[model samples]
Target: MRSLIVSCNVTVDGFMAGLGNDLASLDFIVPDSEQENALAARFREVADTIVFGRQTFLDMEAYWTKVDSDMAAWINATPKVVLSTDSGADVSIWNNTTLAAGDGAERVRRLKASEGGGLVMFGGVQTIRSMIAADLVDEYWLKISPVAVGQGSSMFADLPERRSLTLRGAKGYPSGMLDVTYAK
Candidate 1:
């Protein structure tokens, strides 16, 4: 079975998006370091498919489409599965994306059962919450930044029950950002 990993950039206060749903704070915290590059490469190697919520998929599609970097190329080339209820969603703008409509957990479970590399999920808050509530996430790779936003959306909110995670590893960068990996 392929593992489902929730990879996200989070603030010190545990918020994924700051006031007004801004993620600009994350840009200042990302280090131009070899460790970060290696981490990205590792995730790319492990996951053949990238999963997203509808909004995230659309956002990434708009942003990454014009970029020329390796990350952009990889993201554009890799298969993407967007979980959405909108039957009319036009995913054609993205080269390799498909929209999955129906039960979110059931679709994700079916994806996990399929023969392939690991699946990586980037969230739009509600999607992450639903996955957590359904106990569908196998691992979490959180890049904890130094800044804290007083008010914002939390990545771990609305969980049905307390979920314990075993710390697999942690890497700290010069920029004060910590890349922590946890296993369920």
Candidate 2:
């Protein structure tokens, strides 16, 4: 079975997005070293599919489509599955992207049962929360930033109950960003 990984950047206070849903704060926290680039490459290498919520998919498609980078190329080339309820939204702007609406957990379970490489989920707090509530996330790769955004969206909010995690590994960069991996 394929693993579903939650990969995201979070603040020291455990918030994913800053106040006003601003993501500029994260620009300062992203590691710029060659090692960090290599690590990102490895991450993309392992996941054959990229999963996103409806809003995230649209946002990413709008921004990444114009960016020029190795990661952008990888993201564009890899298959994308957007979990959404809005059937009227158009997702044809990006190549290799598909929409899956209905039971989120069941759809993810079916994807896990399929023959493919690992899957990575990145973006939109509510979607991640739903996945966590459904107990469908297999692994978490959180890049904890140094600064704390006093108020913002949290990745662990509204969880049905406490969930224990085993620390698989952690890597800290010179920028004070820690890449931590946890397994359920």
Candidate 3:
């Protein structure tokens, strides 16, 4: 079975988006070069499906589809499974996106067990946290951004249960980014 990976960027202070992330300064949807583009492409090659939280879906809707980069658009358009209560309109670029609710862990487990590639979480901090608390995340791709939001949104779920991830590897980017991969 393929692994469920929680991938996102965070700051040095352990905050994913400061505290609230209302400003959305932490998101790096804008990759400026071919190398970074290639790196993301490589990651996508291992990932067959991309799971998204409602808020993350909205955020993606606000930015990615409007983008001009074919590579970035292709990545965003990749199979996105959204877990949200909002009945928002779907973007044309996100054609394969589906809405899923209730028993997220079980659904994700089913997704992993079925025939496909690895599953990667796209922003959904709550979803990621819930899955993590449920011991669902098999891998993590944390791209640490240099900026700090001071008080924005958090990446991990505020669950009563906690889990640990084993650091696999980390590489620094020219834009002061550190991509860290972990496994549990």
Q: Judged by lDDT, which candidate is best?
A: 1
- Per residue, candidate 3 scores C-alpha lDDT tens digits across 1-184 of 9888887767665566544455366563334465456556866688878888777777777777777775566666678887655455453446688877657777788888889988888766667777877777888877677765456566563756565778898887777777788888
Cα misplacement distance, residue 170 of candidate 1 (Å): 1.1
C-alpha lDDT of all candidate models, in order: 0.83, 0.82, 0.70
lDDT of 2 by residue, 1-184 (tens): 9999998888888899766556565563665455456556966767899899888898889887897777678788999998887766677889998888877677888898999999999867888888888888999988888887678878887876788999999988877888899999
Clashing pairs in 3: 18-152, 19-151, 19-152, 19-153, 20-151, 20-152, 20-153, 21-152, 21-153, 129-157
TM-score sort, best first? 1, 2, 3
Candidates ranked, most accurate by lDDT first:
1, 2, 3
- Native-referenced Cα lDDT, model 3: 0.70
Candidate 2 Cα RMSD after full superposition onto the native fold (Å): 2.1
lDDT over C-alpha atoms for residue 86 of model 1: 79
Residue-by-residue lDDT tens digits, candidate 1, 43-82: 7889999999888898888888997766677788899999
Poorly placed runs, candidate 1 (over 4 Å): 19-36
For model 2, the run of ten residues with the poorest summed lDDT: 27-36
Better of 1 and 3 by lDDT: 1
**For each candidate, what TM-score against the reference?**
0.90, 0.89, 0.81
